[model samples]
Target: MKKQKIEISLEVFETISELPKDIQELMNKAQQARENAYAPYSRFRVGTALQLASGEIVLGSNQENAAYPSGLCAERVAVFSAGANFPNQTITSLAITVRSENHEISEAIAPCGACRQSLAEYEQKQKSPIAIYFMGETGEIIKVASVMDLLPLGFDAKYL
Candidate 1:
């Protein structure tokens, strides 16, 4: 067997002001959504916003349940809503933001594994890469070119 390594590249922004105007707007929306997250248990509120091909922006906030597994991440909630509401439209970009109970975190937050898988499915369906912008509670931003970069060897429809 041969050893192999994979590396992912992302643009790091010390502040949201460095992002494009439109992307900055989306990030702002994500920040606003975070305030409404129903995260009583964990107190880790998260928000996500998606920009669709139709120029529509969709937003989602984390919703927690007593049963942990039943809850969904903000990223998945936003992506799934886009898939259901705009079946024909492709997702162009997504912005995610997070907040914690103790204090705002400065480091960027990446999507969870399940959220990456869902994003990968949509990326495959559209046959186009989806840009991901993530920001921490304290407002540092990081941009990734594609969902596949987050989930290498991700399971998709092709494998079924």
Candidate 2:
């Protein structure tokens, strides 16, 4: 077997103010969405905001169900909403943030594996990169040019 390595470039910002004005606002919206998440079961709320080329911003917050498996993630909710509402628009960027009721989260929180796969599909369908910004309640923010960075070997329609 041959050895292989996969690496992705990332941008780290010391604070929200360090990001572009638009991105700063996006993060702020994500924070507000997070506050609205229905995550009583986990006490962990997640929010995601998507910026479309049509100059519209879509927001989604995690919705938890007692069945657990029936719930949806913030990333999927936002992406689905964008697709349903603005099918012709291209998603330019996304911002994600998480807050834990049990503790103060200072480290960045990347999307879960399932969320990555969902995002990868949207990116593939759009035929364009969707910038992804992620962070926790505070501290540094990380930016990736595309969801593929998080799901380097993502499965897509090409495999089907």
Candidate 3:
């Protein structure tokens, strides 16, 4: 047997203004969506905005539930909405942002494990990479070139 390794690279921007116009727009939409999040339980709001190949942007906010496990993350919610509404369009870029209650976020927020798997599946289906931009409530922005960068060695249909 042999050992293997994986590597990923990301860009960190000093401010949102450093991003491109379209990316900036997506990030703005994500922040707007964050305001509508129903996260009374965690008080940690997350928002996601996905830009499809058709240039349409879809937004989603993290929805929490008393049951806990029933809650869905912002990334999955936006991805599912895009799947339901624009099944034919491929998702190109995604922007995610988070805000903490009673405190300011100081670093980029990465997607949870489940969201990463879900995104990886879409990347496999679209046969293209989905760029990701993540931000905190008050700090810098981090950009990943692909969802695969967040979920290496992800399981796919090839395993089945």
Model 3 per-residue lDDT tens digits across residues 6-65: 889999998999999999999999999998999999999999999999999999999999
**Local distance difference test, per candidate?**
0.91, 0.95, 0.95
**Each prediction's TM-score against the native?**
0.97, 0.98, 0.97
Which residues of candidate 3, in runs, are more than 4 Å off?
Answer: none
TM-score of 2: 0.98
**Which candidate order results from sorting by lDDT in descending order?**
2, 3, 1
List of clashing residue pairs for candidate 3: none
Total colliding residue pairs, candidate 3: 0
Every model's Cα RMSD, please?
0.9, 0.6, 0.9
Instruction: Locate the minimum summed-lDDT window of 10 residues in model 3.
Output: 146-155
Residue 132 local lDDT, model 3: 99
